[model samples]
Target: MNAHPQPAEDGANAEHATPSGPPPARLLRLPEVINRVGLRRSAIYQRMSEGRFPKSRSLGPKCTVWVEEEIDAWIRGIADRGG
Candidate 1:
């Protein structure tokens, strides 16, 4: 056996690597969303109710998360609108 095994050659581990394209979508929990958007829990929910925020997906009965890209787009929208 080689004392020091060499790293795999290029493409040898391609199957284990993520495919090239857009990165995986990230899910942000309520607290993280709050921190990112500077909105309180109530305000976040309020905006969601009014269709002014990105809708969250329920992971379970009591867990919810927002798509990071959607939230980022919302923020960018606000900036673009000069808010």
Candidate 2:
């Protein structure tokens, strides 16, 4: 049972790859954001509303994602600020 995660079928997570190959990258989804920042959904949104956390990209009415570099920088800043 090779149960590897199937490639994103047709939604926002679908591979943006051309007929050539996989897309250059993937936008980080909410679960990934929570894992990386160690923040709950509400906290993340609150901080975002207060301009404390990096805002996410709105892919569509139901799709929101973050840029990996932005999240990494925010984490770096947290460490630099002695958090």
Candidate 3:
């Protein structure tokens, strides 16, 4: 072995494997969001239009997702207000 350790080119090192930063935000598909929020697809979109729901992030021309944390926070807010 060389006296000086070289950095991993493939990023397969143990330190890189376990990130010390905050966990990545999870993306939730429309169906999953509807199921979790107990709203129909139309209702979800309607709320989105009215600025009452968390806006979705478009992944591409046909794909969209919402941040799981935002949805969870929405649910919590509703519960706090007894909605």
The candidate scoring highest on lDDT is 3
lDDT of each: 0.90, 0.86, 0.91
Candidate 1, superposed: residue stretches over 4 Å from native: 1-18
In model 1, which residue pairs have backbone atoms overlapping below 3 Å? none
Best model number under TM-score: 1
Q: Score candidate 2 by TM-score against the native.
A: 0.68
Per-residue lDDT for 78 in model 3? 99
The digit string of per-residue lDDT tens for model 3 on 1-83 reads 76654556765654456676989999999999988999999999999999999999999999999999999999999999999
Ranking by lDDT: 3, 1, 2
Candidate 3 lDDT score relative to the true structure = 0.91
> Residue-wise lDDT of candidate 2 within 1-83, one digit each (tens)?
85544556554333453465644555899999999999999999999999999999999999999988889899999999999
Off by over 4 Å in 3: 2-18
lDDT tens readout by residue for model 1, 6-48: 5446745544655669999999999999889998999999999
Q: Worst 10-residue stretch by lDDT in candidate 2?
A: 9-18
What TM-score against the true fold does each predicted structure earn? Answer: 0.78, 0.68, 0.77
